[model samples]
Target chain A: MTGGTAARGPLDGLVERVRRDPGAIGALFPAVGRTVGRGPGPSGDPDGILGPTVQDEARAALVSALAAALGDGAPDRLAEEVEALYRFGDAEEKRAVLRSLPVLPDGDAASRLTAGLLADALRGNDPRLIAAALGTPAAAALDDHAWRHGVLKCLFSDVPLDAVHGLGDRADAELGRMAAGYAAEREAAGRSVPDDARRLLSLTHGETEA
Target chain B: MRIFDPHVHMTSRTTDDYRRMYDAGVRALVEPAFWLGQPRTNPGSFHDYFDGLIGWERFRASRFGIRHHCAIALNPKEANDPRCAEVLRTLPRYLAKDGVVAVGEVGFDAMTADEEKAFAHQLSLAAEHGLPVLVHTPHRDKAAGTRRTLELVAASGIPPERVLVDHLNETTVDMVDDSGCTLGFSIYPDTKMEPERMVRILQRRGLDRVVVNSAADWGHSDPLATARTGEAMLRSGFTRDDVDRVLWRNPVEFFARSGRLLLQELAPYSGGAFAGNSILRAQHAEPDA
Candidate 1:
């Protein structure tokens, strides 16, 4: 077990159990939900209508367990389960699935399978989900044009620049040109561009200069 | 609605955040010494961070017309690091400074033995200095951590009223509430508590001894969370006086026990540089005549 999974306590054991018995996915939901709901306060709702942070953490653990449990199947079957989870899950569950894309079984192939979901998330305005999608390991699978659009979408929706993964490393001349164009448009419209845009532009400029 | 954010980290925020917070009626705030996103290798890094909190950050906030005070401590997360144990000895001098308000962000993170020791030691520091404390409850096991925090504070002989157990939610507020310690809620964009949820908490618990803060840091958070909460309260039929008590006066009264909260009236920041040098560039600009 890695250090990160070891820290999650019972969820780690449950993951192993589910790996042996795939039918345990049914039992996994209530267990994870109960864990999420166990912390203090009014506890009548076992489904755990908790804060986003706690929910996100719990959901991420559950998704990891699911992905690991399904790892024995063929790559296509694993992808199907992941897609089903993303499609059938609630907002928090969907976010967890989206975030787990990078760690899912087939690496780049698995990430590519979720292209529709990623594109949809980019088009949507839920910053939390958008950030999760953008920061995921799967985001590296995006083509340059889609990646540039994702960057611009973050700016347009007021999401923090920190949400974008590998921002400094990913900067390129095309991104810089796009940022310059965005800056000029903002100026022409008697508006100011975001500080992050300037930062992105500067990083891209540095890379180009190098 | 002059808000006093009893616990926030301005070190991670930009000057634009300060200006926006000031415009949203944040006249004063306390930047509690907490863990930066990354761990520091030694005690010297902590000293430098503490100095920045009390020195350059204060100066920077003043330029935006906000009063900045700080709470110094060895954060709970760092307490486990043997290298950071030296910080416990150096906290006193910083605690005695003029703008130092309380000892805080100093409770349980992982609830480890070292964290307990650091927490107890800091509580004693608060008692010795006659300062208030801002306790950060562990996010993972908050109810148990909060219970342990109250017990430790009680064992240390620090009065419950002198401590503010922060990062509370619906589950933990009753414990802090019944304990007679001040309650702190950190309103965030997606985590912690939301504006409507906070308003509901206030409605259920009443507004006495409660303080709201943005607790904005190097994460996905909102600097305007306090202001947004105030707006939510008004829209939910809370009186203006109730908003004052929760958002402003509660924090003022809580930290006032330190005898270091100097609530001065600062002039609104007109567009100009700090000592004739703007953040944009280093060259001094002539005063407009």
Candidate 2:
């Protein structure tokens, strides 16, 4: 099971296991963090593993089990539960909840109900929460103003721009202006500007002033 | 320069913060449970948080060679909510857990009757659990809150020495010192008590029952505030032993009442997973073309 090629299968098995024992789903969700180890596995053998951690996969499986348990009849309640889990959860649990948002069974209704959470996360200084909030379908819930600030927060927290979902499609002239202003402030403060600032500035496609 | 931060929320912090803390000579710390920025509506929610404090958080800190211990309580703000009342019943189980050095952060948030009730109740819980108590004074109306807090401690029949009244400023310091309880000052970068202010207080009051900490949490705070205070003490002509006494021994003495401090040197954490969770992100090298 420690072999890299078997990584995807175990994750699938976990989902099926939870689905089969719906009675045990409640116990299993929280246990996912403990049961499936988050260590390096052979899955990303060519160079290295670049995607979600094993714990991430486990959390997603648990959320899927939850969605399956509800069986599309209670999308509103599912959204409510997920939001409560996020709000009351620790940073790790909150991050997991945010990561699983786009995959919620009824995508639109669940997204609408929990959209406010993204903004709350954006306002915090935690890089993990900020990065998770900008991951799309979650990012889609934010309007232009909130989205730009979320990207700015990523830069401020040193969260890589690549963590952001759909950065290419969403980066606009105002975002470029904000990035440029941030760059200027960094320069004035005698701090080195981050590479993401340069990337966001370029995304403006000359719409922003020099 | 070994330090014991008596009140930092390591659960909200990152691994980089831990590495930095270790570098700054922070060898041990206590994380008292407090409000998580948002309100908790259910009692069951507190269980998971408490579990994390005793379980995963302790493991995470061990990985960085910092001894992590926690205090379990229904924080003062949460006491006002009836939904959280049930947590009081479940706290004893957590209080009994190893690595739980104290029963804390249990004091006035709004100075409401509900707050007072929980404060008084947890005081007895601390006595019952044979653990030291960490008390949080209300941020607003702190002097009065400190007065009432001392009053409640006096009423609870717990020894004054075993109770730590935290977040004290200039106005409330003399009173807490007079109360025979341990004085806990949370030094911050901007607000609350500054490191210089902390130095003056130590110089005047002497470090008999004083324990200084960073008390860094979710708000705008610095985890190195405790170390910074130690530096300020040295700059003010205090000796090295004085810094160690206040920064390390003071906290150890206060929480040592629990008989549960994990001060023993831990084997360096080699990225081992705790309960299957590594608390680190996935990383795989790129394939050579």
- Going through the candidates in order, what is the number of backbone clashes in each? 2, 8
Which residue pairs clash within candidate 2? A4-A42, A34-B275, A47-B285, A47-B286, A47-B287, A48-B284, A48-B285, A49-B284
lDDT of 2 at A2: 52
Q: Can you tell me which runs of candidate 2 are displaced by over 4 Å? A: A1-210, B280-289
Superposed Cα deviation of residue B276, candidate 2 (Å): 1.8
What would the per-residue lDDT of candidate 2 be over residues A55-157, giving only the tens digit for each residue?
Answer: 6556766788877877788787677667766766777666667777767865667867557677556645577677778865667888786687678767756
- lDDT, candidate 2, B1-289, per-residue tens: 9999999999889888998999899989999998787666779889999998998999999988999999999998778667777899999889999999999899986566778888889999999989999999865445667899999999999999999999887778889998899999998654467888889989888989899988888778999999999999999999999999999998899999899987997765555677666655455222321
Error of 1 at A205 (Å): 55
TM-scores for all candidates: the values are: 0.58, 0.59
Error of 2 at A45 (Å): 53
Which 10 successive residues of model 1 chain A have the least lDDT summed?
A: A40-49
- Winner by TM-score: 2
Candidate 1 lDDT over A65-184, as tens digits, reads: 667666645566667766666666656666666766766666544756678567656544566567767875678777776687677666665667776778777878877776776576
Writing each residue's lDDT as its tens digit, candidate 1 over B1-289 gives 8888887889999988988999889999999998776455479999999988998888788878899999999998788677677889999999999899999889986566788999999998999999999999865445667899999988988888899999888767898999999999999764477888888888887998899999999978988889999999999999988989888889999999999898897775544555445553434344541
Q: State the TM-score for model 1.
A: 0.58
